[model samples]
Target: MARTRTLLTAGAFALVTALLPTITTVGAAAADRDGPGPVAVSESRGQLTVTVPPGHGGPGYRLLIDEKTLGVRTVRAGRTVLATNPAGGFAFGDQHATSVTTWSYAAGTLRIAAASTAPADTVAVAITPTADRYDLTWSVAGAPAGARTVSYQLSSAGHWYGGGETSEGAAQPYPLDAGQVSEPDFSPASYLMMEPYWYTSSSVGNYVRTASPMDVQINKSASGLGDFTIKSTDSYASTVFVESTPSAVYQDYVEVVGKPSKSDATPAEIAQPLWNSWAQFYTAIDQNKVLDWAGKLHAAGLGGHTIQLDDKWESNYGNLTFDPKTFPNPKAMSDQIHSMGYHFGLWTTLWINLDSANYAYAKDHGYLLAAAADSTKPCTVTWWNGTAGIIDLGKPAARDWYTGNLHQLMSTYGVDGFKFDTRFFDDSCAPAAGVQAGDYQRLGAEMADGFDLQGAGVRVHWGNQKYGFVIRAVDAGTSFPELRTTLRRSMAISTDGYPFVETDMIGGSLGEPAPTKQVLVRWAQAASLMPLMYSSTSPLGVVDHTTGKPVTYDPETVQLYKNAIARHGRLSDYLQAQARKSVADGTPIIRPVFFDFAADQRFYTTDDEWMLGPSVLAAPVLSDSPTRTIDLPAGAWFDTVTHRVITGPRTLSAYPAPLGVTPAFVRLGAPGAATAIAALSHQS
Candidate 1:
């Protein structure tokens, strides 16, 4: 039966190959060459075919497959089978370009070799197919003279359609620019040539413009999805150029289908109650001390949602065992927190300590990435847990083992969610030497997959840049639904359409001093519109290193934070409802100034002012100056603080902005409203 099944699969493959003209033989023998150089045409699984033109001069050869021109490459006569960029691109002189190459077969591989008369320059390129994507590897014989960079363009077809690039290497749906015009006929092919810088600027400044018509439109009526069609153009053939430089343009396009309904539960929603913390809860304050703080917050009307027992709960950093002395009875403590109306959250990174019991198992099983003998060597950097090694999440058994341990922690501690941190560190530290380059890419994808399969809502911190190939897997909306932090401009951009987008309350990192009264008000006013909000303060009360003093909040500053928290709590239901609408309909909580003032060209470049939903416009005083001039599009706006009505398309006169005030206004008749000012104050 087994033999028959194998034969049946082989026969099925053969049948498919016969029907598909693109399928070529794998590992076929090379033909003889009589000219100055060998011009070989090789096909792989029929989906991709490589043809090296005769007398291939210069340092490399060009790749043409499946009627699509992939990129140009440097070739060597012998010694190396393939030489190409780990990241894809074409380089001319010193310039690097962005582009994409599409593969046909759902699962297959391709390799191309070239022989050149130039002994100094040799190159080989290899392509391997996965279930959903392709892996490319390139090798060069000797280093090239002068600077080299890769330049290329991708065909926006299938899932490779319209999207924006992030400094983190993932492509996300571009935000809708109200006044900004998209080219007509802006299909995927037309916009695909518009190369947005992958890991630097998130704006359209890096895109390419052509004489041909470009047809593309951003779909925000539903969840943020980009649908585009590229009309065939006669001017330029669909080609990807490769050059050598700072890096290669390795492009990854993800086919993400938006949620059908806005009310659908996000990973954060499902995992909110499961949220746990490290030993920070106890270490920040003693058991009695935290109980007192928790009681105070409860009394202050500040409800505790989740009190995560951070790192200190463990016996040691690397040892996953509980610190019996500190935790005493963790179950009792967990029950106490629950009784106080808060869930539990825990933190764990992938690094394991040599002293831990799991260390022997990991070392013996070939899971640890460090030598047991030398702990001083920077196996991975020295983490919180002294002398730790990263666990190989790439291996199936290793992943299973890690998952089982996590499950054990949850079951034993009655924990809600796991704050999975540093899983990406695996990219830098592989368990074994000589691992294939493709294997490295696969490792990131596998780790993301493993986290999803583990059945726990994983919370990912920053570090999206390391695994450049994995889109949104970091912030990609796959592994984590809610992000930990949303920096200033990031909040404005990401919240444009993404639902469940949360930002830190009032102040971001607890280590920094709390915001001034005015800054606090502005931040709170902005945060109130977001789906998720929290107040995070450093428990250590240590002075900031840069400022060199413990952060002391003035009475006014404290009052403002308290007031904002109180207001947010009072309006939580309404705000959450709006957030639900946003999640459901792709409406942004924190809209850009341009969205509301689309017709006004002046607001296109303005980043300081933004709309907090449809009803309110928040113009924060970012500069240290006493007053700032604001550009308001034609509209009747009423000041929330003073109830003063001001007409649009005019500059508002100077107003006293001493440390406590922000120039914010509410739109006259926009729906879904909330304001710091009373309605009667805005009477006609």
Candidate 2:
């Protein structure tokens, strides 16, 4: 769904999400040890080595992936101090915790209890084996009476990654700052845990399953240290999963959180070409304008098979009904759009704003979140459009009320699907009695139960991957740098495990000022190859009302747009098949090069180039360079555009990319994926 946004006067950027990532799966085997009883060991798929210092307690372990040391167990580094604040909501583990209470080791698991005399708080640490990862749980069973929080840390010695939850985060690594605590939020600034999960090229990954109210964060300290910390609200049990590889590890994570299977969503449905009206009309929409655009999209031969009407159509935020003044006779407009052979989708947020038609009624009931005694004060959060009473989907009646409304949008209005979108990704929602931020998706997921969900989240929780929607990149601008950031984030997100992905329309989002013809054409070409052919920002330009003539671009860019759409339309099935595979395992359709060619360490850090599904290798010209180098692994790659056979495991000179033609190659192994692309595209 498109965003209902006011340009951030500051940066004009938008919120974002990290796809299919969390948890690692590892399995059991014989236990081994280099130290005595307390220092037991489990050599499952990987290995977990525990160390209980010669005493009653103080037990920790070092995680290893592919026989590489993952991270050392948690321990306080210096002299410990104690502070108790009654009004405090933030706290960290004491710097000096040198005492150990007890330790035990069994088949593929380590359990240890520790405490310090200064704070008199007892902490428990357990390491369990899984199918593709090691699960480390740190729980504090008893806390000093007045103390509101305690902390724990896991230090891994290597370059860190996975906290790419900011404006241009995916393009670079972050300093180990606690994500939530630092209060640096964009729509979905890494849902804290310091973007809670990460991995290293040394072949390791981490996901912190923050147990309820507790805030966990991880980052690489400036002083050559990678740290993972969990700061609990009170007593907490924070779980961390450490594993290996972008694909295998991410799949392992998804296996636990769960993603929708092929049945829940058809690749064909996802492959449908979409035309959104946000860019063309913004909020200045009307029934006539919508119909005109729908007609224009198809008539222009743009291949926009489906139509998505973004914000401003609704009377108020979260109000499902179309505004009477702007969209009079909604059904008629829907019918007209459908008559033109286009699928229709509406947009909505989950909250019920006070300004909305349903707000008073929702507030009358217990549908909105509220503080302990303040029944009149609706628990609302302020964001892009003032304050609104948020829905507590956990309340079945409220959920049914919201979803029931959605069903009507489908049956009555002929709306085929929706984009479940959100703008505020901040962590202040009122969860049902004991619900935590991570569980926020409980309502978000259910809201999408019976629809074609073409939705996205600016900020999402840990279990969001289970929702199984095509995740779009954060709204991007036309600036070349934004495009580069988008590419990097796409690779990171794909590797993080979100495979079914879509990008912003070619010229970028409404946030970007108008783009140049060159930028627009190239952007469209890149987007055309993506799983979903989308245009939130319409490719059409200003139109003459009286004459009905196209006004914006020089003819070349417009023609290029049509051609790109037609080319991609021919290969929709190929892209769909890859999506099916993604649901089966955790394979990212748009993946980092290393996911497939793992043996080649050179591709481990590759960013500009990527695999579209399993066959097409696309290296877009991000800069103004006429040509760039194509790095091929030790295999044969057939240049789709050039129709030339190229051997890999080598770097070769590439010619400049034509305006809309990217330098792409088809892996000989995936003949169909490669050949089909080869036949449809070319190099300049």
Candidate 3:
């Protein structure tokens, strides 16, 4: 009976195996016959295939990366849309080409030209191939009516990461079906960094090579492969880079777009942790309060080389003067801060309040952005504080005027630098004289050229990386979830090619409840591993609002804070070295874990962890629970807290993590690993 049962099971397996190949062959034959009408012109180079179908209703083309259809686009009278047939394959619908005008692959380039219907006279796509990568440029000549957008599609395979900065869902790859994503512009308030780039786990990368306003719209097909509809109001070019790993793809992107350029080396000040007065006082700051806070931080052995005064210090929003009411003698305060061995940095914004001293001067001289509704008057828009006019940084004279005030502050009051804030120039009051938003953002960074280190939002331009300021992570709240948000956004921004990353304050920002003792300690631990560790609320004096008194953290908790700061200080040299190297070759000092371990698929979707350059991996506990899991990449890793040697690709579950320590590891033989491990051990 047993032999009969075995024979029957083997016969059933043989029957299915015999039929599998026949079924697959039939499916392939059917798929091959489904074409996009008749191809008027076809060309192939490297791994790309360009097929142009003659345009009658519209001019369109389809690209296949190694025979896999990348996407299909058709331009009509008014709008352009990507067409996909019901069978999850490429199609042109009624936009099938009538004739091919120019079909030529000359001088290592493939150009396919076609004639379309009304509104669009002609449409063409030029492909420049290099190895496995392709530079795709499409031009739509004479579209006189609706939006003049540069529309194209990209493969949305595997997981997609990069649409500027957002704490919401940033730790995870982009949702394939999110439709139209929010905050698609270069607004730091909404999106901390607005970079026109994205990379997928499929080892594909895209960099929209335009300073114009561009929005990345993602739409996924029934099959996981999807579309990246780049809806730009202006014409632009883009590159689709392919490499063996995502890191290599990013390297190619930086080389093509242009690496960050400033001085030959990144300034050393970028690596130091600093204390600010925003969350600590919330604009209730005075000269005495500034000095007192600095003193308290010093006495507690917590403050770094910089003591920054945040919002509400200036008399008016854009006037750039100390408030005489709160800060009676600004110079004396600056001197006191300097005497305490700390750089005195003030918070500065580009908004000019209507009631400011310089409002009349700015409005009369056209230094402020003119209102689009009425060009004769300055554009007065509402912000967090109130209605104000934004300075036209796009204009040379206006930029000089703003920076002149900044220089005057430095010369008169011994101000070291500024923490530039509120950088977004919304569409309502923007491009007064047809200036692009990118121009304003670039000019803003250029203003910091002759100044000290200034923390600002990440700006993407040809050489804007040379601005020499740390890219600050978005401000977070005081809860465990917000702590996780800070990590997510910091990693996201760094991954976008802004290397020098600064995290939020040790605790949460204002309006949120004070961080709990455990939260504060954990936040400090996580921040300690980042490039810059900033603190606005000290762990020693977290306020218990219910009792109207300080929530005293135990000695152990205070020691944890000290250890975190000490760890950052000890690792400052290594961090600065990595930063300087980034200035040379556009590598990020703080990046996501998958960046270094791209071959390990286990970490492709991991977001809670990060890498410090190439040596250290930081997986700080970012939740209420102290225990966490860490997936170590391939190779031997030295555990900092436990002093244990672990091998990967391995995952440690329920790792013993307590409030006293951050979970970090050093790859055994990476550059500077020994020194880093020793310094971290000293802190422990």
Models 1 onward score TM values of 0.53, 0.77, 0.80
Query: How much is 589 displaced in model 2, in angstroms?
Result: 1.2
Tens-digit lDDT string for candidate 1 (499-560): 34444333333333333444444454444434444433422222333355555445555454
**Looking at model 2, how many pairs of residues clash?**
22
Ranking by TM-score: 3, 2, 1
- lDDT of each residue in 1-684, candidate 2, tens digit only: 111112122222212111312223222332322223333343332223332222221122343321121223421122111111211112334422333344445555656555433465555556653333445655455553222232223223233345433443333322223222222231121432123455554344566555333232333232232333443343333333333344554555566656545423454445456677665666667888888778877787776657888877888887888889888898998898888887788877766677887898888887776643453566777755667877676677877887888898898999888876663223454456665545555456556656776433223445555545666666666666667656655555555555666665566664446666767677766766666665755567743223444447776777887777666666677776777776777567777677677678777656677788778887766665667777887777877667778888888776656675666777877736654564455432
Full-model lDDT for every candidate = 0.40, 0.55, 0.63
Off by over 4 Å in 2: 1-102, 113-123, 129-132, 140-159, 167-195, 211-227, 234-245, 263-268, 372-376, 423-427, 433-437, 454-461, 542-551, 671-684
Task: Give the better candidate number (2 or 3) by lDDT.
Answer: 3
> What residue runs in model 1 are displaced by over 4 Å at the alpha carbon?
1-289, 366-387, 430-486, 492-499, 504-526, 538-558, 570-574, 581-588, 596-599, 621-628, 656-663, 668-684
When superposed on Cα atoms, how far off is each prediction in RMSD?
Answer: 16.2, 12.4, 11.5
Better lDDT candidate (1, 3):
3
What is the Å distance of residue 635 in model 1 from its true position?
A: 3.3
Better of 1 and 2 by TM-score: 2
